[model samples]
Target: MTPVPEPLPRRVTVHLVTGGPAGPRLFGARVLFGQDPADVARRLGGLSEEAPLIALDVITEIASTPGRVPTPLHVDRVVFATPEAVDAWPAVLPPHGMEPMLAELVAEEPAPAVDRPRLRRMASYGIVTDPTGRIMLSLIADGFPGAGTWHLPGGGVDPGEDVRSALRREVWEETGQQGVVGRLITVSSHHRVPLTGHEVYAVWVFSHVHVAHPGPARVLEENGSTADCAWFTPDQLGGVRLSATTRRGLEHLVGPA
Candidate 1:
């Protein structure tokens, strides 16, 4: 049996040439290196032989991976084009009329930045009821920005960690309650960019829990992210300051409590 040959890898040359008074402008040419690397290099915007250029290695789209953000520069103007659109290599690139092309490409077809703002979050909370049928909740002392806001007895889900496991740990640490997390109560999320200036793309998950408790909720750890913890009845939930998550938790587990 004959073995199939792998598809040829696309190699590319990028040109960084001075655009008149503007700083450096980038352009690219790509083809299978085995077919015509030198030709592709020559066609990259027909950059002048004297113009300074930066050589880079660009693999085929299949081989491309997520990368770091490119530094933005203050340029007089930038002229750039994708290699795919240039079907036939021209003998000479037009020197004039770059402004219109630059406007169309840069403004209309803005390149997706590698470090664009992306939302990411994950949390787990357990629901525990006291002998009076009151729900266990935690008060944020220092961590959650809202000092006295009520929150579910749970916290963030660490990577490579099970959802139930994270909930169990958070419940113990924040409320001094021991429990086995039960079926999921609800899954909800809200989007907001943190001021910390980090970009992370993620999905959020929530679950309901059954606690094997000896008594009411109390802060297990001293001076933890949670300031204080307690069990509150449904009638009292409305009067107390509550986080959105806490409100949602109440709405899902029991109606409007």
Candidate 2:
């Protein structure tokens, strides 16, 4: 039997961001040195000769921080890429040894800076019900901006509120009909809007047994978010316009039955 070869240590180049919000920001490339340090340096040095200075900075950062550095000591906006040539790294690197050289290299060259916006988020759901209490489908209003087509009678989950409560509130507000939540159906996501997007998780639910009122459905509030809520049978959906996500939600709620 042949002896199994030891797995070559994987190499990764990581970008480190250092500096305070008010002070100058520095970007450094760090090469994750594996078994050998000297070989790592040689490979990085060769790459730096051909690649841009920014690439060199990233390599230097990785070489400086080996098994011990905590992630937060670095600032935000670090980029990491797996090295394609793992075998080229040196087999022997000194422990706790490369920081001084890395510091000097980073001092000589600094990285460019930019501001990134914080992501804003909100959660909603699709509530559906079927006829004869078997399947459920939520009513969706058409022509809402960015919604494009189909939508469920659900909206933003409030702070500290559970998903069930949010779904009930959204259903009542959109459909003006009370319903009891049944069981969780499915969860889905939609990213039609560029910066602001919606993540919807749906639950199959039955109509509240107590509430009994019905009339011609029309836009009750017209708050610019929705046009009107109208229930549809699975067969009725054929001609009516619906969003792909909403359509998918309907399928989950009522599949073949």
Candidate 3:
């Protein structure tokens, strides 16, 4: 069977008109075309033939107010793009004179909902802290059969298990460190492995606790889900290779400074 092609990224643009007695007028427009130069030329040719040419005089008249001689009106260049690209266009064009005003007009649209059906699974992770509020992390055993990235100690909440209870149990089972799970920090949604399957709902808790003692952290069972754990400072957090969802969860707890 032939492999399917991935969707192409879209390009978009906005046009702005300034001058005349009244002030300025802004127009939002878009053109859908592929990235190839030939494709772009073809689309441009089609547009030139289909759309009537915009007259400078008409643009000036529209910009001018009653009894006021219209100042030299400037019609900015035309731009093109798909709907998504158009929505994300920058407020201002070139010439650097109209950036502030034009940028205000550029707006971001919300992402469309995911279409795939996924099982709703909840997992809780505790940002467990020591006496000085340093975060705890762990490394999985070499024999463990899972993604071998260093991660916070936690696990999936079984059926009938409360989120906090699950966190405590998982932490103790994985790291042998006992601590109380505290307030809820944030919840994030992420697609499961292979990106073509179900989604995982992860809840992160900012728990306040003191570590009783430091012990060797290891993966007792050879589970194929998690492999290692270790403590990470905020600076070290960035260097650790974590799943996208896990990174998002941690970022939620430690917001932009």
Candidate 4:
């Protein structure tokens, strides 16, 4: 029998890049263990902008920069976006992006208690509801986390995939339903040791998706994490065994389920 291969460990680095007439400059970078990097950056810089967090796919942008500060750290990806882009999600920020205190924001963040290999992932989920106000949910397939429990229809965002596009694809694959993506509801994170025995950190972005006309729901993906799908009235949800995140999202979007 062939042994199952473990997933490669993952890490995230949040870099404070400044923008202005002087051009984009690498301000500082920090390795985040389990906390959400965007939220940390927001609190540290006191940014009031409501733009999306952008992911940096290239490493040379940080590794081969001039005047870069050295830290005892390693990372897998970087998030580079300015908070001052007014009407557009520009590739960089404006002159007034970060506060002057950003240089001192390079302190290392706390890691998870377990010292196993770390994997950080961002996923997009939807609180899918039809015009009739019934919520749609999917059942977890056997062998995955929360097996047999009902869960929100979504999964990890693929590499180079757009967040909203990923959510729409996941909704259709897991529930065979289409929804118009709406305002972002909330961002939630959870850390755990999974069956693979890896230290997994999941950052979930939840949004409100509305379906105009509905149809019978079913799982469309082959051998996917979702085993089944169905629509539930608000009263009926109380008896369903919902995944922790699903329950949390439900309580946040609507009333307690």
| Top-lDDT structure, candidate number | 4
lDDT of 3 by residue, 1-257 (tens): 99995422212222333223453333433312212221232354343324322211110011221234422211222333332223333442335433223233233323337665434334567677766556776554455423555566666655445556777877777766778665445433333444776543322333333465655655454553455556666776767666544555567567631
Predicted candidate 4 versus true structure: per-residue lDDT over 38-92, tens digit per residue:
6655544456556454433223111211247542222223344463422233345
Which candidate achieves the best TM-score against the true structure? Answer: 4
Q: Give the TM-score comparing model 4 with the true structure, all chains together.
A: 0.64
RMSD of each: 21.0, 20.5, 19.8, 8.1
TM-score for every candidate vs. truth? 0.50, 0.41, 0.44, 0.64
lDDT of 4: 0.66
Q: Which digits, one per residue and each the tens of the lDDT, describe model 2 over residues 71-140?
A: 2122111121124322222222235433333333332223214232222223445544534432223334
Candidate 1 local lDDT, residue 56 = 25
Q: Estimate candidate 3's RMSD in Å.
A: 19.8
Q: What is the lDDT for 188 in model 4?
A: 52
Pairs that collide in candidate 1 are none
Error of 3 at 222 (Å): 4.1
Sort by lDDT, top down from the best: 4, 1, 3, 2
